[model samples]
Target: MKRFHVHVVVPRLDESVRFYSSMFGAEPSVLKDDYAKWMLEDPRMNFAISARGGEVGVNHLGFQVDSDEELTALREQVVAGSVVVQDQPGAQCCYANSNKYWAQDPAGVPWETYHTLGGIPMFGADSRESAAPDAGGACCAPVTSIPAVIEKKVGCC
Candidate 1:
């Protein structure tokens, strides 16, 4: 795979960007009004930050797979290793389209394993009526509001 991935939600975009840029010693590879990403070679990590108004802490952790096969392997391994809370084949998130599998660690931290297919112009797309609800919720909606809705609809949260 390409690298390990980490996504965090912060309270302020500009402040967080400056903080991470100084910490990483490089400007963001992708920057937007509320999101920024660093493709750091030193540690081989894809670190992303967003001021999308969440709980203001570590949001999710992940691995960036090299290909669909690699993603599939990881998903399979995860399903075998832990209970997969959600799986989305064409998830639109963080301005990209990805195939993702979500699972929660024992500590209740969500882990995302995905292979990014390509970029999109938006942070998130509205789900089709028949589509399964995204575990992360739509657009910049509060993550806290999602679990109850998801659990109600799918019996998993």
Candidate 2:
């Protein structure tokens, strides 16, 4: 099975959590000082929000798969389309450990495809040491001036 993933960067975490909790009709399954996540079954979605400093809007979109096989299958499809994919195996972000692939769309929207392996204590580790030059502080998407293209760098969620 796969769950659709949506991560948004908000200006205020508490206020956003209240709004989303009411809208979703459930509290977050995972809540932190700066992040919250709802593993919603009705829509089969992994909805997350963070206040870690970025453009205050939709941060990235992705899919969460159940198994490595599914992730590989998705990756194959994305690669076939000639999309530049960056693979991060055992990435720690969003209070979870995951194996993920990051890419960008035609309109410069970031996309992530990942399979969660387990949980982590913190939001994420600093990725500057391993990230590409263009990869910004955010963990999910690579910061790029050019639309529809990006390099691999891990930072935030």
Candidate 3:
């Protein structure tokens, strides 16, 4: 099964953890000095957070690749279609050195291609933003409808 992942940037780790731990009825699987990851089994999502300098909101979204081959295939697909590709391998990101590629969809939301290699503090430890690829745009899709269909179908029955 494919699991959807969402990374968030929170100002206070303790508060965020409290909220999620209550909402999900379990503590995070991994806790770090400036990060936390909840490997929730019910919904099968890797919800994580970091100390990025930003307003409290989504940091990024990602798809888990089972192996190096899948990562390579996804990279090739993006390269053939998209205008930009951001590749960062085994550096520290969200406290893990992961093998991954990054790209922006029509929206500017950054999509990451990664396989965790080891524990680290940051990704691309040496290359500063100046050396990194330009962020294409906003990052990802915008909600086009309100009162979304799923909301209508889902209710306390």
Which residue ranges in model 1 land beyond 4 Å of their true spot? 128-157
lDDT of 1 at 4: 82
lDDT per residue, candidate 2, 1-157, as tens digits?
A: 9899988878899999999999999999999998899999999999999887656778778899999999999999999998877777887778888888887788767788999999888777536423632333565444443243433322344
Listed in order, each prediction's TM-score against the native is 0.80, 0.85, 0.71
Between prediction 1 and prediction 2, the one with superior TM-score is 2
Task: Tell me the whole-model lDDT of each prediction, alpha carbons only.
Answer: 0.67, 0.77, 0.57
Q: What is the Å distance of residue 17 in model 3 from its true position?
A: 0.2
Summarize candidate 3's per-residue lDDT along 38-65 as a digit string, tens digits: 8777888888865434445775677766
TM-score of structure candidate 3: 0.71
Off by over 4 Å in 3: 121-157
Q: What is the lDDT of candidate 3?
A: 0.57
Q: Which digits, one per residue and each the tens of the lDDT, describe model 1 over residues 17-47?
A: 9999999999999898968999888999999
Ranking by TM-score: 2, 1, 3
